[model samples]
Target: MNPLPTACKDEVVLTLPTILLPGLGIPASAWNNVKAHVPNAYATDRLDSHSPLSLEGQVNRVIEFMDDRDIDQAQLVAHSMASFIGEAACRLHPERFTRLILVDGSYEERRKACLRIPIEKLIPHATLRAIVQEWRCYSFWANELREIQRSHPLRTRTVVIAAYACRPGRWVRKLRRQAQQLSALFVPMKGSHRLMLDRPEAIAALIREDPPQAQRHDGYAL
Candidate 1:
């Protein structure tokens, strides 16, 4: 099926821009090589972890970013925490998205679903920042997790790509099966979770596999 378009009419973000997000301790530059392969992709920075958000806040941030770029509908590609961010966004607004290309998305799913500790309230703001500077992780913010869990599937075309060599053979198989159960097109690639840094062309090629219709294409008016 053809991919959807962004809400904007002018300043088209064509070539099926692959909106990319990085996991913890990673930076937007991780997708630089990947973006070099995929001309229209957009990857955000994770280095400035000075500010972080809850799941809802993260999703809203993505929506707002898309709004700024006039990207109404685009494929979501992310790793680790950022992968969850895109997933939460798709779950919240399924109609606004198309395909999801998740990398290491199901990383420690069972382990990461713990209760959120009110670290901010327990400790001083400066102390909290020093202790855990990064924003909301999977385990915290139980309410948002509940909402995502309770959410009905929007029937989005999902794809889950895993690291080919990260886990044991049995565990990897289990993860692949889990991806399938989640209704995602499972693909185990040859690398670690941070494969984007080493193999951008490979990642870009995968994204290009299902190109979305661009807003600036001829005869396809907004």
Candidate 2:
């Protein structure tokens, strides 16, 4: 018997994750917690190493996935590094997305810090699962925790804005240095490392606040 197709393109509520992180340390089945609430949510599987590590690759994969499933656009809710990819997609192909809801994290900070860290000297296996364990274990007591807290979406947008603005060109430079990058600035929220897992309800509520395509049919976009 032919196996069932993995990607689902139906026009239901959609939410995607950051590609860098591996499943947020949560079980795939745990995603049902959010999916149960949304109408039809599809989660993209982890990317193969052969795929480009640049943010554009992530965006292309999503676009391709949707295309394969006959989906034109979707409502994206990205977590962590995935937020960067979502932002890139929005800027490059705004029409392809209806609404965007970035979870409690950002890639602008992560990519820079990770690049500086001597990963090969630190840990050869730089997989998402390994990173999660490293975080939980307090492996790098450098400045990850502080940065993570600062990137919380719960933190007043004003505060986050000020934090980034005060940093001068360092943050922006890191983002700009990346050639094929997502061009959206992510909003930080209040929560620990696991933003979505720690605050799914809050995220879901925020998503619900976004007016769907059906509601915008009145010729007055929200």
Candidate 3:
């Protein structure tokens, strides 16, 4: 395992994780391929069992973590629901972010709309089962994993990779509601959902191409 640099005292660059999933999944480890290209990158440590059930809570946690880590500014790359949090942070404090790469970002409005319907509501339950199921075959994650891939079909290489790391279950409805509020605030990524792991190469190239710029104090929502 590559240890995070200990003495980032002069300047520390942080990489925050996506919501409702661990770093081992989706964007966290997947981003390792492009780490060498980044100047300074440290994955946000797991927040206190406080999974991002809502965008605000997630963003707040991230902000607090940055304060704790003394990360004054950063280039954010968020996948899935976590993308919304990153956007919120940037909007809340423009000077905090150098640049943002929202991959496969599921906006608050869309996610709530998805949960409002009868079938998509299963996502919460599915997420729950996936997390607690002892037998992998019995896990709710398998079905949800299959559904996400089916709903947002991507290249086979990406599909295979995502399926391998899925840990599906139900996210808290309260959290889902928080995510919905974000719909009014930010624009959704191209794929509508699941963009990062699904299109790692593309997103990585985008991040690599856009060199970090000094952040301006003017707060703007994106």
lDDT winner: 1
Model 1 is weakest, by summed lDDT over 10 consecutive residues, at: 213-222
**Highest-TM-score candidate:** 1
How many clashing residue pairs are found in candidate 2? Answer: 9
Predict model 3's lDDT versus the native: 0.40
lDDT of each: 0.66, 0.43, 0.40
- List, residue by residue over 1-222, the lDDT tens digit for candidate 1: 223443345744346657898876676787888887676678876454344557777778888878888887788897876766777777888877778887766445444545446565555655344235444455653346556857656467877766666433765576578577677766666676687875566577667662432221122221
Instruction: Provide C-alpha RMSD values for all models, in order.
Output: 8.5, 11.8, 14.0
TM-score of each: 0.74, 0.50, 0.44
Candidate 3 residue lDDT tens string, 12-62: 443332222223224345555455444455555332323444444556777
- Model 3, poorest ten-residue lDDT window? 155-164
Q: Write the per-residue lDDT of candidate 2 for residues 102-184, one digit (tens) a residue.
A: 54334332323333243445545546544443333222222333333344322111101101222335543443333113233
User: How do all the candidates rank in terms of lDDT, highest first?
Assistant: 1, 2, 3
- RMSD (CA, Å), candidate 3 to true, equals 14.0
List clash counts for every candidate, in order. Answer: 1, 9, 12
Of the pair 2 and 3, which is ahead by TM-score?
2
In candidate 2, position 117 carries an lDDT of 41
Residue 197, model 1: Cα distance from true site in angstroms: 1.5
